[model samples]
Every structure is written in structure tokens, then in C-alpha cells.
Target: MDELVLDGNAAAGALAEIYGDDMTTVLAECASCGRVDPIGGLVAFVHAPGIVLRCTACATVMIRIVQTPSRTRIDVRAKRIPPPPETAR
Candidate 1:
């Protein structure tokens, strides 16, 4: 709940740690399978500014990041569903 700029993947418990200055891990439980993904590997989509990120595991959309012309944080949130874990890959 630190409120750092993060991707939708980060919201799904896929990220292990905040891996960069631009991102943070937003931890939450999966609504579907109830598995803990730690928001790992897939957070790259969230952390990447202006670039859309998809789940590396399930190839489903995680979230979208919009950056200013200067590439600043615009908005962030979870979507309809979280992606499956990498094991699903």
C-alpha cells in the first residue's frame, strides 16, 4: 500500500520485489485460482512506461501504462482479472 507506480501484473502477486526506480510491487490475491504469484516476472508490463505489458505466463493482458511526454506516472490500477502464473506458460 505504499502507492508506488506499478503495473497491473504487480497487483496480482507476481512481482518478487520492486525491481526498479519506476516500479513497486502492489500485492494482492488472485480472484480466480487463489494462487500467490507475487506479481513477479509479469510486472515488467506495469513498470514499463508508455508501453503495454502482458503476462509472460498466460499471454493475457495485465495492464497499460501511460507516461507523460516526460514519462511520468499517469495512472495505474488492477483490471478485470489477473494473469496466470508462469508455470502456466
Candidate 2:
């Protein structure tokens, strides 16, 4: 999965919207009631409350936003890492 550059505010929605990809699929969960929710990005989502960011698959609750005003600064880019493969194996 390729890391994407997203605006801090839209990071959750961006991930939830593109759930089909391998990278973002890491954000989903199933409830006892058999309902789906996307549970992801709890820490960063606090910039704004009432915003829903869930897992990409089971739709589990991940982020609980509380307080945030306009002009809040957040770094929303995923760090790039090289995977160890062929040679390492």
C-alpha cells in the first residue's frame, strides 16, 4: 500500500473512503449487533468532535473527537519505510 499525503482534517475520511486498498483496510470492525463501523485514527481525529472515523473493514469505532478549534496544526503524512524482502529473506 502506498502512503498518501492527506490534510490532517480529512485524513480519517480519506482513509475510510478508500477502504478497498490493502493499506487502509487496517481500519474496520464488526459489532455484536452485526453492524459495520470503520474504527480508526482516534488520536488525530480529536481536532474536531462529532466527526466519525471508523475501521476500513469491520467498521469499529476508533477515534473519539472531543475538542478542536480552527487553525489547529496537525501533521497528516504517513512516514515512508522500506520493506525488507528478497535479500533479507
lDDT of each: 0.37, 0.31
Q: Each model's TM-score, in the order given?
A: 0.34, 0.25
Once superposed on the true structure, which residue ranges of model 1 sit more than 4 Å away at CA?
1-23, 28-36, 43-49, 70-89
> In candidate 1, what are the lDDT values of residues 1-89, reduced to their tens digit?
22443444443332222123323343433333333333334434443445444444444444444445443332223343334233322
For every model shown, the clashing-pair count is 10, 18
The C-alpha RMSD in Å for every predicted model, in order, reads: 12.2, 13.0
lDDT of 2 by residue, 1-89 (tens): 12331222454443333332232324223332233332232223333444444334343443332223432222221222122123221
Cα error, residue 56 of model 2, in Å, equals 0.6
Output the worst ten-in-a-row residue range by lDDT, candidate 1. Answer: 13-22
